[model samples]
Target: MVDLPGFKTFGAASMSDSHLAEVTGVSSNPGQLRGRLYLPPSLQRGAPLVVALHGCTQTAAGYDRGTGWSTLAEREGFALLLPEQARGNNPNGCFNWFTPGDIARCGGEAESIAAMVEAVVAEHSLDRARVFVTGLSAGGAMTAVMLATYPELFAGGAIIGGLPYGRASGVPEALAAMRAPSGNATELAQAVRSASAGYRGSWPSVSVWHGAADHTVAVANMDATTAQWLGVHGLDPAACSTEHGAGWTHRTWRGADGRIAVEERRIAGMGHGVPIDPSGSDRLGVAGPFMLDVALSSTAEIARSWGLVAAAEVRREPAEAPVRRRLVPEVMPANDTAAPPASAATSGVGQVIEDALRAAGLMR
Candidate 1:
């Protein structure tokens, strides 16, 4: 982990470190996932919960620290579940979204994640109806897996620079899936439907985000992702409403219930990272590898859509220590020995920048 030299977590100067409370040890079942939970100072009953997944080569702590989910949770009086992928599972630390076993229901990482969510709900005074999930890259892909496999689990979710679930079974196919094939949107959505059979529940609303210039995961994947959710929600992609953001565009399609079922974001001139707002306004995470200092904040945008925060209203509560406990993995099923998802290897220069961004934050 790089100490970001000269950089402090936004507003860390005035806030006590204890305000960012986290407890390590909750188990991600079936997969025995190593995971942690962030707590807010004041636990309001029925508060919203967010399950955040990190991108490749990033740890749960690294992603939470950089993205400021803990900070947001504390302020908004919500809880967080940040799950980490073990190195043994995938050397690159990317979620195994491409693996068939991992993406399937009641099995592999997907089932384990659902189990983790149950763990969080069991212990806390949370509103099961208000759960949401989001992730970046491979994490983003896994977010799609969780939302699709267990559509009843989430109210909404956001995917940043990710592809549709069930589109690939391995690395080679994953690479090919990024090209956004002819009429790819239609194909991707159908693939999601086939992922789970005989499921008739309200599909989660989706927020799809991708930089127009993202080279790591082609922007085309965003189109396919948008199509996947729109198809699930049965909304016409062409008949959508549009909202403009600084350096980005948001397109939404309201469902029959008069609520947004699908929304897509196109960040202009951005790259392969979660967009961060450098200005004090809308700041959630730090600027580092895969964490860009763009004019928009995906975190803030996502939270508002989830109904966790209000427009122009960001809260910061007093410091409160969190409950801590050690994780105890349940006995694995005999037939399941698959490892958690792994991260993908990127270029040397990209590694340097990512490491430097991490280092800069750490150093401060």
Candidate 2:
């Protein structure tokens, strides 16, 4: 593995660490990664499971603490799987999202995580159909890898400040792509298609979150990632209905059946980090570096989107149906047609800046 000098994880120390148990008996860990788990005291049979990946320089425990995922899992009664990276694998403690072997199907880090998920489900009798994944920064990119390589395993996924799958294969390419992501919708969709070997199974729904003012990873990646999934689902890019909320722009695209297949949220004036509500009765996640207090909780919003939160716990007015425009008419053989859905921090230049800082005795 190529080591990028001075690349460090900048997640601030969390207030309190969550209780996480190490997972054992995982079959064939080719990635040689560590696994941590959080199971509620009272887990129902066939409960849901969520696999969360941590960004570079962050640990499973630290991620759980900062994101409040474990706390939410305990309340929602779902199991949590957190895959940790060893220093030997990547000096910066980042998942090798850009590496070919690590992200490949049935191999390397991807397979190790898959095996961990399999073991957890079998041991806890968790529901396989409801499995979901989400990550931030490098972890977010890895989330795309999982969805592309193991499409059948996840019902849905959320990517926060991440890149699309198959965007880079080496360190140099990764850095360039991070600074300026390149790929038309068709090209991006083809990359996923090539990775999965033309698997025709039902595709997982996608949720994308990004910061408009993020200097680490450019916001253009959000648009690219969205286009990639839109092409994958065969949805019209122009059919989206946008909602303007306070400090954010929410956009949604629906499938033929009218279910939301893709959703994007761009937080105004926010930097590269997961948005959280630090002071609220319904708050989730602690505010820290890369964990900003944007008065909006991505953790809660994601859980609600995935139906993990109880209806009573969510206090919101009913949403009027999104206004969608079908620009193209579908005439499928005059019969029937159906469609399905769908970085990290500073990649590239982020590494350059870190290196300069370290060289100048500005950063350790």
Candidate 3:
């Protein structure tokens, strides 16, 4: 049996609440990356799947503990897939977001993660159509890689403190890009297109989250991220942007089919880290290390923004909800990016478990 040690965190003790979340090994791990699956006790056959990626120096369990993703999966009836970066991949245990070899479509870290996703989808009998991915910092940069390379696989993606895709080919270039101002929106979007020349399918909806005071990654990168997605969706750069809850400046763009393709959250005064909501009402993760409580819950808000939480998932009778759990960012400076129409990110996962069992040669 693996030793599961409990840890404490600020805000609510939500990290401790994840004791019940069981992390299982993937049945057939094709991805060079290590894969872990978080399954709630009340698991269903065709629940939605969420792929959660960790940042630099973070292990899958550490990030989940602080972020409360496993807890959220339990409450929301979703399955969680965490693709962890091995230390050898990067000295800091960061995904190779800056390495050209790692982000390619068919091989390296990105494709390995995709293989992991496919295996988990089969193992859990998950609804493939409902898949979504989210990440923070370096992981966030990798998240952008996933969306661009595997647009046909994910419905939507959330990037927290991440730079634009294909912005850098190495660590030095990554550092420079992270500090640069948001570049031409059209050019930024074109980078994504160039990354995957043949993928012309419906682009995944994007949600951008960045701290206003993030010194590690310049706040301007958020603008570049927003601009990149906006240009992809063909939205006007000067479209009117608006304010949402707690100084969250937001803008959304929709396609001719009436589907919202992109949305961005520019949090005022937030610094480098994943912002957590101190309010127990909506707290999703704990505050530790790169996780900070800054009056708003990025995890909860992003989940809702991703269109995953149904009314029943959040509004079940109080008597029926599980009890216990204590847990769990600065807002970025304001920019003049105007809000477009109020469209938001679209939301997802099923599998033939027995078929997977046979494929893995675990069953005949």
Candidate 4:
């Protein structure tokens, strides 16, 4: 039972309401790892779970605040788990995705994260089969690590502004590849396919999001990553093409493997930030549109395509009726004129959860 430094907890009763809390003693790695849990309006057993990972220099709260995932979770009736990186474990407060030891099975960051997931599931009523993971930058890198190492555990993953891990060729090469700019789509694709082979079950569907102008991660990497998945699934890499939007450009790859599918999104004119919040704070670096939207939509699509959710059931209900509760007061900003500082730096996870709950009308 690891105790966090300044943990807090709060909740509301409406089915559309959300609960905020600084969960401590949740990570098995005491003193080294801790996480913040965002419970949505409904916690009936078997609810979906989405584990949101943060980038370097970003806390769990900061990530939640910057991205507004808790709000989405509340509206969609899912649990959002934000795991914190202890300073002792990661000096920059970033997950050690580049380190071979960290990426290995049941050790380093992987073990700590897996333990956190287990703890959350054991303590809460999370639907084990519907579990998903997504992240940005370094966090995105970690998300890729989880998919490769624990393919059996995750239903799907969304990688934004990040790249795949270098193969067992060696740590130096892997680290270099991880840090290198995105280019050579063929190599990137090969790496993903090779790494994914280690998984015990069917490969999980993946959605990759990258920015065209992302100087940090490089836009080329997106193509390479997508090609790799296409190759592995026996799909034509050349078949993938680009789609332009007013402010974004999306690249997609669609293929079927029994129940799983693969897809990707590349945002144009975007930097190394989440896609949805174009003007997001510098703490997590530059962001484009909300990546959460992409994540949720992709998740929902995969659920339906893979039969995790019945298409008829989701389509039968009207959006208005499904919104059982609304917490309008909680969402209105204290001052509409002033922009809140990016929540990733000064605020705690509790504050992010609160904002999400309020934004979704799940809190008062």
Candidate 5:
């Protein structure tokens, strides 16, 4: 419960028990940036942390409200940090993943985001071993950049409806790649492989979720991302399939080190929106129970398998209640406690008895 200076809480009932704070500050270069922090009501000394980044045309609040991730964090006892993009950073409020300096190993938006993570971790009780990063669309691209540049900082990442990596070329090339039609799947796949090859450490485990019908980011990006991870990790691409669910398919690539696990989830008939229900106006798709269930389920599975979450705890049941009429200890005979079987009765005898009783009582 460390008091964050200049941070304020939002009194929404869904997160009333959590500590919410918004902070605006200058980074190392004294450049201004804004971010939001969601701390659960009861956190361990060093709780796991999740850094959630928003997509285009979305702010921290909009992202939090749209995804309902804050509520999940509150209930699950994890801290959430959201780094916002100011209009000055990108005209459309998107992180400049296309900018040359921004795409580099330690420069531009990548550096600022890394700074933000460092700031929050320094001020909070974050477990260094259990930090995760996730984002959508442009935010997802930025997430890829973070994974590439700051591989040591995050345990893993989830990229939803995003590209494989950001380009260090010019914005025009980046924009062309961003707006490229869905047909050029091969070239896009090559680009992702090239981008990910630059990472220095053991590749981080990654989970990608894409809609089969997503037009904005294009569903083909999932194929490209999967190919990139597989190629880099020397996995056989032919082994992938769409048989996981009726409207869902997945591919997993394992690296030689056995620590890197890359997977893709392709949802049938889905769009560029976060696949959730009861969604806010800012969300991309219809919000419903399914979206949260899917996201949380995926997250939990990853955490549980990766040792990010603790193992299941066992509990003992209460003993049976004492018998209403206890026999005297000296006179009682030992007998099995199991229930006794009743003698077989004539078929329809109960019905006949009930009919007779009803007739005698003049009732049906």
Candidate 6:
């Protein structure tokens, strides 16, 4: 277990909420993880369920408070499931995403979380087809693990500051991948498919977010993640539409049916954290360590993309006619460079690996 920094532990009082309660009686919790469920008062019998995973050194409620996931769930009338990482599992309270046993389908922590999801859906009579999952950093990487191992279980998934699936199989490899993720579109896509072989079902839609200035996890991982999902969806990487905003850039790739199968958001000048807008019209999320104030709420935007939030709930500008075109950043910033192409060899990253490991609290 590694001792990481930048996250504060909340007390038991912070973990208590009226609508939030313990998720127990899971008959197949092989990962030995604890869970909390938040059912909004207005939740209907077939409400949507969102499984939100917190980053390292954070509690479920603390993450819920910072990201406003429960608050959004209340307003949108959706069910919220927060799978917590126990200290016993990882001393840093980070999910064991790189552990082979934990990430394998129907085993270890992945299976434990899957069992919790199944129990919640069954007991609450929720809509199975509308279930979604999302997470931050380590939780975000685990999100990829779940989406890869159990694609049939999720309608959509959002990864914030996370790595691609199967990029690492242990802590040292995980840290090295954090410093620089390796693989091209085809290789990365094969990793996801191989995770769940012999399944020819529809893939879940994906949303990815990363800070341009995130030193903890390089922004290049965002591109690697996007490439992996785009490969899974079989969409051309150069065929997406781009939208630029005050503090971020957004890209979208549509499937043959004209629906967005994979989308990416690159936030300018932001660091390693979940971007939030606490004082926005929606008043979503609180700013804290690893929860940044970027004037754009990832909570609201992600829910909106998921079709869980209504237009009236979010303040909007008049819609502009979008021009379909491919836009690429011509020059990489000083801190972030283009990731190596498919199967590219990597070297001279010892210091970078060390720095990233320290940033993630994975190294002393």
Residue 301, candidate 1: alpha-carbon lDDT: 78
> How do all models score by TM-score?
0.79, 0.83, 0.77, 0.66, 0.67, 0.87
Write the number of the candidate with greater lDDT, choosing between 1 and 5.
Answer: 1
**Residue-by-residue lDDT tens digits, candidate 6, 60-126:** 8888998999999988899999999888877767888889999989789999988999999999999
Model 4 global lDDT (CA atoms, 0 to 1): 0.57
**Per-model C-alpha lDDT, please?**
0.72, 0.77, 0.69, 0.57, 0.58, 0.82
Best-to-worst order by lDDT is 6, 2, 1, 3, 5, 4
Question: Model 5 scores what on Cα lDDT?
Answer: 0.58
* lDDT at position 339, candidate 6: 32
In model 3, the runs with Cα more than 4 Å from the true position are 1-31, 181-183, 311-364
Model 4, 336: alpha-carbon shift in Å?
19
Q: What TM-score does structure 3 among the candidates reach?
A: 0.77
Better structure of 5 and 6 per lDDT: 6
lDDT of 3 by residue, 1-364 (tens): 1111111212222323344333344443333577767888887998888898987656777788768788788898888888887655564557878788888786788888888777778878999888999998888999999998888888899999887898887644665676784458878888888777588888888998887667667888888898898888788766644545544556676767766678777666666678775455765766665687766677787778666664223322232232222212122112422222212211210123332222111223
lDDT of each residue in 51-85, candidate 4, tens digit only: 88877556776666556677556656778888777
Candidate ordering by TM-score (highest first) = 6, 2, 1, 3, 5, 4
lDDT of 5 at 24: 37
| Ten contiguous residues with the weakest lDDT in model 1 | 323-332
Model 4 alpha-carbon drift over 4 Å, by segment: 1-27, 167-175, 178-198, 257-260, 277-364
Each candidate: how many clashes?
19, 4, 36, 16, 7, 1
lDDT value, residue 83 of candidate 1? 80
Cα RMSDs of all predictions?
Answer: 11.9, 11.8, 13.9, 11.5, 21.5, 7.4
